[model samples]
Target: MSDPFTFQMLVNYLIIGAGLMALGTLGFLSRRNMIVMFLSAEMMLQGTALTLVAFGRYHGNWTGQIFTIVILTVAACEASIALALILILFNRKSSLDVTLWNEIREPGQPAIVEDPAEAEATEPVPGVESYPVLTPAGIEPEHQTWTVHRD
Candidate 1:
């Protein structure tokens, strides 16, 4: 059995994890692209997982490993949701830049149009609209639906 508080080894791992976390945070805060921000979030989670696993191994404890597994599950769900959002944003505006996504500023309000003429001149896409439509079954309002896996 190893001493979990071995100062030198613990300090080394902590420093490495802290550095990774700082870099991830910077990347997330400084980037406007949603994809880069999501990747940075993943990096932050990876750093956390590394720290958790290192502590688990050092202490011969299972709790940290279990926590790491929970983090992994959360990360998976986060990534899936972020990817779905990115696809939808891209489909709508043809850009993944977060700066371009200021359409909805208030709840229960239709997204603001960038140019009134553009909105009026163009024929609307079949399923795309300024507001999502509610279905009788309480499904995600139709305009908000995106095929997760379209053939």
Candidate 2:
């Protein structure tokens, strides 16, 4: 049998779980991409699961593991539904940007609009290409034209 979890181990697990939750929250709130936001939400769920497992192990009970399993089931279902919704939304908007779906906001809430001037004022980073440069490899093959007789 494995040695029981020490107090320090429990504390470490809790700290790591909390960190994951914090990062997930930040990503969810700051990112505009639907996929990224979904991943962030998943991260948060995983963090909670981790914490639950740690607690359950520490207490020598099956409750935490059971809860984690239940959470995993719910998360799987949520992922499928969320993916379908994202596909439909992408089809409608031709983009995964969350801001494009302002119409779906609460009825009484005002739409948030970004200032065009501020957007235009932002400058690109100096001495950095927006895309990666791939080195060319090998020589190009020679092409030959062929004439075919009609059947």
For all candidates in order, the CA lDDT equals 0.79, 0.89
lDDT string for model 2 (58-116, tens) is 99899999999999999999999999999888777777889868888999999988554
Candidate 2 lDDT at 126 equals: 59
Clashes of each: 0, 0
- For each candidate, give its TM-score against the true structure: 0.63, 0.73
lDDT of 1 by residue, 9-59 (tens): 766877888888999999998887898999999999888887887787678
Q: Enumerate residue pairs that collide in model 2.
A: none
Which candidate number maximizes TM-score? 2
Candidate 2: 10-residue stretch with minimal lDDT: 142-151
lDDT measured at residue 61 in model 1 versus the true structure, 0 to 100: 79
